[model samples]
Target: MVRMFVNGQAMSGGSIHAPLTDARFLGRAWTAPRYRFWSFRDEFPGLEPVSTDGWSVPGELYAVSYAVLRERLLPLEPPELELAVIELADGSGSLSMRVRAEALAGAVEIRHPDGWHGHLATRQPG
Candidate 1:
């Protein structure tokens, strides 16, 4: 199993969580305060590592089998995202998705202390 950090729809109760049905949820985790969070057309969250002035993004960690990672999760990812290693708040590395540099042109910066879920909360219709 490999550790995977997910900050968006792959989390619990999310639309894209089916792929992880067999994976082990490892509870909540945070990214090291060295990345910026983004939303590409409000479709998915993206992570961009920054040199300075970053914020911790809330997310979840899971122990996923190689088959799940390759055959299930990855195929659902958008073209704008690519798998990359990211540092957790505890300084541990885990595989996560980062926005491709080329895709930034269409991204909108998002600053929510609670991360993707928080952003989604605000977008709900009253």
Candidate 2:
């Protein structure tokens, strides 16, 4: 099984969390403090590597079998999101998804590393 850090709707109780149903939860994790985050219309979020400075995004880590990642998760992901190699706080590389550069051209940089969760928490019912 491979580890993936999910910081968006794939977390427990999130909208698109169905794909992780069979995956094993590995508790909470955070990224290295050198990445930026962006929100895509609040439906989901994206992460980008920033050399200068950034925050350590908080999220849930999961250990999923190779087949689940390659077949299920990847297939259900949106076009704007892509599997990315990220450096976790533990100094290891993991596969996750982030927004494409083109899609983030004018997107807002989430001020807080854990902004995604915070944003969603404050959302009102439509």
Candidate 3:
């Protein structure tokens, strides 16, 4: 099983979480403070690795089979995002999604303290 980090729709209770229902959830995890979290039209979130200014993004970790990664998970990913290896807060590596460099042209960079979920909360109308 490969450790996969999911910060967007594939996360638990997220729109695309159906594919991961049978996967073993490791736990909540954070990325190393070397990524820029972005929202693509608020449709989905993406992580961009940066060398200097970056933030730790929160997400869930799961142990999934290769088949799930290639079949269930990957195919559902947006074209603007790509698969990449990222460092976790614990200094370990995991498979995560990062925004394609070219795709950041109009994406909004998220600066909320809570990262993805925080951004989502702000989007909710009360």
User: What are the per-residue Cα lDDT tens digits for candidate 2 across 1-126?
Assistant: 989899988888888788789999999998888788888877788888888877889888999988998887888777888998899998987888977877886667776645678877666577
- The lDDT of model 3 is 0.92
Candidate 3 TM-score versus the reference: 0.97
Per-candidate TM vs. native? 0.96, 0.90, 0.97
What is candidate 3's CA lDDT for residue 47?
94
Candidate 2 pairs with clashing backbones: none
Name the regions of candidate 1 deviating beyond 4 angstroms: none
Report the lDDT tens digits of candidate 1 across residue range 15-125. 889999889999899999999999887779999999898899999999999899999999999999999999999999999999988889968788988899899788889
Model 3: residues with Cα > 4 Å off, grouped in runs: none
Give me the runs in candidate 2 sitting further than 4 Å from their true place: none
